[model samples]
Target: MNGATTSGELRAHNRVRLLRAVHDGGATSTRSHLTRELRLARGTASVLVAGLAEDELLHEEPAQEHGRGRPTQVPGPHPRGPLALAADVREDAWELAACELGGRVTVLDVRPHDGTAEGALVPLGETIAAHTSRLGHRVIGVGVALAGPVRFGGLADIAHLGWRSVDVPALLGLPLRPAHGAGGGGATLGNDTAFAALAEARRGRLRDVRVGLHLHVDFDLGGVLVVDGRPLGGASGTGAEFGHMPLEGGDRPCMCGATGCWGMDVGANALLRHAGLEYGGGRGREQAERVLATSEQAVAACAAALGRGVAALVNAHDPEVVTLSGHGPELAERAGETLLRACEPRLMAIRRDHPPRIEGSALGWRGALLGAMESVFDVFLTPEGLGRWRDNHPDQGRDTPGRRNVTHSTPKGDQPP
Candidate 1:
């Protein structure tokens, strides 16, 4: 149990919700705008705002909109309290960032290390602790975004890392709380690409789109399908391993133990190879950029590979939009014309009228971090958690925003890793 609740606890919960709403909604919405967005009354919104302001979870200011009637104030980024963390583990490097719950991000630290060993996680944990030490005790949970396929809740295997059966939970030494058989704060892990898709869906390109595809092309190409705004994790959570799909008779081998896989044909490594470059240590990055810079040949190869893969998907699922995250978006912009050209022929000719919209990510790299943060928040900010908090702190529950009990379902939003 979380002790006892008071009117103060109620206020805190509502404030968190309001701040989350603003973050999820992208740009800050006005108090009235938030009321409409969250379906709360103006008075209730005001109460929520006042409470958040008291906790410093939100900042409010008088609105300057040229209108009559009662003047309304807009809620802005919170000045302090509670921060979210995001970690990006690429082939030979990692980048971690601290994002305020309001969505502003600060690159906490970036380290170049061979992620091939499970021992690599120790330094990462230390880095995160050092980075957040300045924030006092507000750090809640850590969100990790890995470069390869993360299986289940404990293992992550990526050939680039030469890590098979790596115990992620143990390596990170993440603070583990006793399982209460219910909701509480704990370490949350997400595939980098999946995290990216979540970020894009919630805060980036697919924000309002009902159904879409988010493809992240890194060392390993990964993707996820979103229907009605929620990612289809399928049964095993490895639902969109687009890179592993065979590319007909291609010769190259993939890290996922498959020959002629799409990643062998379309991922960053493929792009690097196309440009006659080697992997490891920024060389591939420089080359990938060069390939995208010199000519559309390398990019065209990627597009063709992606188009074939997409055609198969479109023929089957028929998403409304396809938002490209990571290198996918950058490739689209640099070699978009080629991608479109390649896609045209591969797409279903019969349904030419409704081709999926393919575009770059709106949030760029920030998408992954933001999405990871959201995942962490979901653990402690759910209806159940609020109920627990209320039970422990009864007095705090009365002033809090009342749960509508009515379930309003919206499509899953976008995210990137």
Candidate 2:
């Protein structure tokens, strides 16, 4: 069929528009709200919702209101269907969560893993299988979040994991078809920091803020720039790799094979190292508490390094607010005053009229899970995304990964990394 005379094409396009509207407007509201926001007729809205409901992508519920003119139902959670496995891989531990449609999450398994070896893949695959079996076929997709830079084509550059140029999809294994009563076979992978920033910017803390910067300062320093509520994915998927940036006084070899990197000075490792503890992969929380407990020296250093990073981001993009996530917010609570103070010196005095607000992440550590869940919905739970997947790869449509989920475990018996 010619592109112009294609009924499938029209349906796919409309589906995408409707889903996009729902996404932009956070929680699903009333049908009239969707109609007005999307500029679609009432009948058209009804048809779209009906189609979405058929796919188990959306559940319409009676609106919580009195004297409603005709009975109107708001779009609720996705009908109980397949579950998606979201995995977060870090140096010392792995966390896998089971997420249902509309972003409800249930963490299934947590275990120790090689910070940097293919050996870690074994536990990850098992976790996926175990969770999928428990939840049954409702498992629709898998999303992966790694602790390092995921280069283009979903390759990870995890330093502490000692992983360089590791392909995630190949390592994580494919989603198996349900054995008996099981369901779901979709998958997608992503970077942990990138996914976290996306979740924070869109559904979490920075949602209402239009232009913002999200920084995850942990064992490493990673961040993303959000303009108009969408994080920028630069060419090669490294747009916001903030840790590798060079600093004047810094003098250590970074995992990215660079000297004097910003991350080495500000990340969780740096804080741990400064406190004279074991700077391994799993000591994130312990080290964080140490920073909070000690005489603000490590915290000051983190804030100083982070302040420099924020100032640079502000100067380059001039965002309205810089949202800190992961351990960044915890650090902020301890050293926010110092961070902002450092920012004042770094910012150009000439442009004192507008300085970006240095703020804590609203989503905390759960942002990655929410963001990864969005991709799952995009691939299976939404009318538009599912349609596109069906049209492009019909054979692999149902058995594909949508987004990667991220959760990391800290090692026990450590002061903190």
Candidate 3:
């Protein structure tokens, strides 16, 4: 995908790499150090930075903390730079945010809706339309993190919300795609837990980890396997359904149409089941917190189940670490010891004393939204994607970076939302 055959292609390719370096480095990167990191000549780095500045993609200023000899240039997002809209669609509420490079995100809107597709998405679509219209072509793409498993082509099955085979893109009013290889400009749909796992790898506990398992446990559970700094998309882009793996071996008849799912004994529903409360979502999260606070027996049981099932996954995947998000942090805190006691013996005897750590996510609830932003940028930051962006924004050359009338995304690195 990065064959630089022509000079123009080579520039485009290097431009992407430069932007990625700035994004990954966040505020820590300087032009001088980027040259060393990318193994690019000083002049080439300067030229790339200059091109980006002139194109209204990025601008540089004198670095306060100088590296060595001369003053270094710190790259910052341009006022007119490309942005990605990240939406986290939950069982009860939806959150919309605008994001720029360097992993910055600003909450645009947050509201709950009736438990219907029309009620939930119509308002979200209206907000997206407002932002896109105000920002124009700088809005590159949109990414949605649904509380469900998303198929490779964006078919979603949100079992908790009682929705299946939902055409998410059409509902969100995404522009119709041209033929294949026509460049990237559309919405990216992915499972919430999978996207959260990616955010963990990029900016949270799983950062710098090679192989890691990340699970988001709310009412039920879902997950993704992050390997080599990337989220591994399994066959059909729907893998890591560890919750439905029957780890608990209970015939509780899960909402996923499965019997004996591991999720039956792990998430808020598991806690609620132990507490004699009906299973619920959204506002049910509040009920789960009450159970966690009041029922020690339920906490211990849930923790044990979480630990035991995680042990099984550790054996199967052998990840370096495991990160949990959503209500998982509280569960891990309340019964972490209990879970570990149940987990340690189940691992392969060879590594029983040194099993992978199970820690709460550093990104908290924002992981899914940030990961969705990364998904859009992952596609649209490429050479072809940028080419498409250029075609759409022909006036980019005449545009200048300005802060007036623009509310830039606040830079937040792994902070709780």
* TM, every model: 0.82, 0.81, 0.92
Q: Per-prediction RMSD in angstroms?
A: 7.6, 7.3, 3.5
Which TM-score value belongs to model 1?
Answer: 0.82
The most accurate candidate by TM-score is 3
Tens digits of per-residue lDDT, candidate 2, 167-270, equal 66676666422111123354566667777877786676677788888888767788788877777767776666777778535777766788888888776787
As a whole number from 0 to 100, the lDDT of residue 417 in candidate 2 is: 8
- Candidate 3 per-residue lDDT, tens place, 80-195, comes to 77888899998888998888777777778788887677778778888788878877788888888888887866677876677788777777888533212344767888888888
- Provide the overall lDDT of each model, using Cα atoms, as 2-decimal numbers: 0.65, 0.66, 0.80
Candidate 1 residue-wise lDDT, 268-335, digit = tens? 77788777778633236666767767757888888777767776667666888888777777777766
TM-score of 3: 0.92
Candidate 3 local Cα displacement, residue 236, angstroms: 1.5
Worst 10 residues of 3 by lDDT: 408-417
What global local distance difference test value does model 2 have? 0.66
